[model samples]
Target: MKPTIVFDLDGTLALGDGPISAYARAIATRIGDDSFGERATVALIAHAAGETSYRDGYHAVATLAAEDRVSAEIVSAAYDDSRALLGTAGATVSPPEGLSGFLHGIVEHASLVLATNAPDAGVTALLEEWAIIDLFDAMHFQVGKPAGLVPILTAALARGRVLSVGDIHEFDLAPAAELGADTALVGPAAARLEVPATMRGRTIADIYERISGWATSAPHTAS
Candidate 1:
């Protein structure tokens, strides 16, 4: 049996907006005015001012949802709409060379999965649009990665070994580490995050090369 590999979407699979930023702009527009750009900027500024928690920065925009500027229904609609936007928003981005091939290769060697915090329906649409839905065997949704790391690892290990990869170590790798799963950190560390000495995981700057190695070594096949 091959290892099970759990991957993060956003900055991990493709370059795109962070979770907070994606909803921030949309929620702002629905609340303030028809001008999404301007309203988003204002909400972002307020968030930077420490008016709200970073994870719920969109809440700052939601506050304005009570205004007569737009109906609450419109504001609620923005949540799903914004998530769909993240799918096509990063099209011009140049994926790491051979990234698709790497992902395909990895899928062959392991049980591949997408584990992200994104709302399920929206992220599914995005991955389908990217034409990478087949590369993964499963997809885990909102609030699943950090704390859910143990279950993922346990299930994956039932078949073989497990490797967890993601953009934010604080949100992705720390919890995986607690379960003693191998880890790969994709992006920069948070300002307040501490790096553990003798970390069991590896830091990977290139997702393609890493997945390629895993693919070539495992025993799996993909459509």
Candidate 2:
């Protein structure tokens, strides 16, 4: 059996601001603040540039909403609303440019897995729309992360080596690392997430060659 390479959904694979914007709209509507979306977008940019302390856009917006005294009940409802729009036209989700090609190139050497805290919502449709659903050997949704990832890693480890990749260290990479799996931390959060990642980069594309090296355990093939 091939080694398993696990990836996170959302910012880690599906990239765009639609989902964030939707989240902002929900919070702003609840708080009656129309400018919340713009402010949240600005904060998201800052987070990506390593200028903010947030883990990512969702975290920034959630924290801001809380600061505004939005109740937990309202906050959760807003989040659920945004999550329901994931992978749809409202969410504006799309794969990183050329990601499909890179993943396909390495598919033969490794078994790819998609694991996320997200509900099944738009996941299947999004993968189908991207025309890359079959690339993954396994798909796990509603994974609680940081803790929920332990069993998945354990199973993968039992088979062979495992590598878990995600933008967030705490939710996506830490547990895997603790279980002795190699990890790749990607996306904006990676800049400030000083975790023990076997590979880290600001974007998936930035570490393509490195991932390929580990996947093939040989010289990386041409991208």
Candidate 3:
């Protein structure tokens, strides 16, 4: 059985600044305030980048904007708009350096799966933009992390050794760890969180290289 590796899409497979900024812009635009958008963008990006929890930053921005009633509908609408923008003219997603080569090298030896909280369209657009859409053996989109990770982990276990890699300790790695999967934490935000992980790297490229080396040394038989 080929070793199974589950990858988080945003901030893990690609830089998330662009899309996250777009979400802030959408929220600001919806509220008809450019200044608010700028501030929200910073706060939201900080949250997405793992500086704070999503609820914390989101509520803080709402409060700062004097919005006493920040409903789920508003947040969802802004997120939907952001996804639309990313799929169209705002598409600036870029794969981590050397990711293409690394994926190609490990594809034959591993089963790669993409699991993300982002909507399907956004995930598809990013993967297509990066030209790695076909590399994944499976994909789960709009997966609410932590709780949403259960199904993904359950499925990957049947394939072989399961490993999860992402930039968020709570959303990406913690749940996977609960399921008994190996985990690799990537990026500076993850370092700041200082969660226990099987491996840690400053960037996705570092994690990729580490996994590649491991796969080489202990190659799995692909089913």
Candidate 4:
């Protein structure tokens, strides 16, 4: 069977201009200013860092919003509304070049799974908008990249060599590497974290020349 390849959604397969901007705009409009929106984002991120678990992280952000009298229902509504608007308009989304062809070429030789920090509903909408949902074998959401992704992939695919393709080094590549999965860091820049030399076996730049070589060399028949 073909090797299982996992992907990060935002800033990897899809461009990164959806919910964040919408949230900021909504916050600004609601509070009658932009400063409050910025503060809310900063506070939300800070809250996320103090959590011990994924559920904790989610609740932390929810707590902040609640404290500010921001209704959870409203937040959820805004997210859905923004996603629907973007899906139909496609004005805010930028599809990465070569993504369709790349996926198409390897669809016959590999299993593609999307692993992302994007919210479940939003991710689903984005996939539908891009018309690429059928390409993936499975998807994991709001899990913050490869930190717990190796196990999820293992469970989904049974047994196979795993390779992760993503743009974020810390969230998308490092943890997968630590879990014995191959990693191809997509962007041109190096990671802020210091990757150990031994763990560097599968690193690659997001260039066609390099990608072609890696895809061809990794022998696997599509299941």
- Report the candidate with higher TM-score, 2 versus 3: 2
Give per-residue lDDT, candidate 4, residue 36.
51
The models' CA-based lDDT, in order, is 0.58, 0.84, 0.73, 0.57
Count the clashes in each prediction: 2, 0, 0, 0
Best by TM-score: 2
Where model 1 places Cα greater than 4 Å from the true spot, the runs are: 18-22, 33-78, 89-97, 190-207, 214-223
- Candidate 3 per-residue lDDT over residues 133-182, each given as its tens digit: 89999898888888999888888886667888887778888888888788
Question: Could you give candidate 2's per-residue lDDT for residues 1-223 as a string of tens digits?
Answer: 7888999997888887788889999888887898887788888878768887776788899898877788999888888899899877777887877898999899999999999988888789888888789999889998998788899899999998888889888888889878888888888767775656788777788888898889878332222
- Lowest summed lDDT across 10 adjacent residues in model 2 is found at 214-223
Which of 1 and 2 is the better model by lDDT?
2
Please provide, for model 1 over 1-223, each residue's C-alpha lDDT reduced to its tens digit, 9 standing for 90 to 100: 7677788766566553344455655665555645654565576565444353433334445665554465677776876776665545422222344566666656767788877776675566666666678788888877555676567667777776666777566666677667666666554332223555112222233445545565456322211
lDDT of 3 at 106: 95
Per-residue accuracy of model 4 over 115-205 as CA lDDT, tens digit each: 8776675567767766788899888877745456656766544666677767566677677666766666543223333443222211232
What clash count does candidate 3 reach?
0
* Runs in model 3 lying further than 4 Å from the true structure: 44-68, 217-223
**Of models 1 and 4, which has the larger lDDT?**
1
RMSD of each: 7.0, 3.0, 4.4, 7.2
